[model samples]
Target: MIELSTVYFGLLGIALITYATRLSGLIVMDFFPLTKRMERALDAMTGSVFVAFVVPAFYKGDIGVKLATAAALIVMFTTKKILLALTAGVLTAVIARAVLG
Candidate 1:
């Protein structure tokens, strides 16, 4: 039989290991030389990660939430107006909640 204390310590150890592994790259990255290709790759990686997080939030979300967010993204992309896009998205969400709920 596994002791509760042992199980807790085991889980904690796993979490620490995972965190250390993820952070190791960031910690060591500065040690390396930055080439033009590496720089471009890093820039693209930022946008890719942003899209990865945002797309699922829009597509898999509730209809109202998705539509509102999509509208915001479209506006932000076309006009590059951050404030207007944010206001439109928030208003859409508020209206949707008021009407739907």
Candidate 2:
């Protein structure tokens, strides 16, 4: 069995890396300026990253995740409101799991 300290340190390392990545942009931007093309690429990169993370999970996840994703997509597209879409999706997954259990 792995020791608790090992797990704690591993999690700490992950947290530090995440924090550094999030802050690196601001730190570098302080001295370096972005061109319009670079800025647009950065804007698209976030969405691409989000999709990269989510798309694989959507294909592999459970029924609840599938239903929630479908509901969120439909609502978001129809209404063009992210908050409501997110709410509807989460509620759908929670209720689906509760009913299933």
Candidate 3:
């Protein structure tokens, strides 16, 4: 079995590499002017990336998680407040887990 410290260090390495790549992107972008097309693509890319990260887990998560995501989505749509949506999601998850389990 893998050691706990090894897994911890592996995660730290992954995080550092992720940060480095994002930082490099920012650094490189400074040298180039973003055209309208590029700006549009970047804006679309953000939503695509969000869906990529969320869709799979949303597909496979437990009932509590699904309900939490729904609650969050509703709150976000109605309030346009990220913090409140996140709070609703958390509270929904807690209540759903307790009730469902």
Clashes of each: 0, 0, 0
TM-scores, all candidates, are 0.62, 0.70, 0.75
Candidate 2, run of 10 with poorest lDDT: 92-101
lDDT of each: 0.86, 0.94, 0.94
In angstroms, give how far residue 85 of model 2 lies from its true place: 2.9
How displaced is residue 16 in candidate 3, in Å?
A: 3.0
Residue 88 in candidate 2, Cα distance off native in Å = 2.5
Candidate 2: give its CA RMSD in angstroms.
2.9
Model 2 per-residue lDDT tens digits across residues 1-101 = 89999999999999999999999988988888888899999999989999999999999988889889999999999999999999999999999888974
The CA-based lDDT of model 3 is what?
0.94
As for TM-score, the candidate ahead, 1 or 2, is: 2
Deviating ranges (above 4 Å) for candidate 1: 1-30
Q: Which ten residues in a row have the lowest lDDT in candidate 1?
A: 58-67
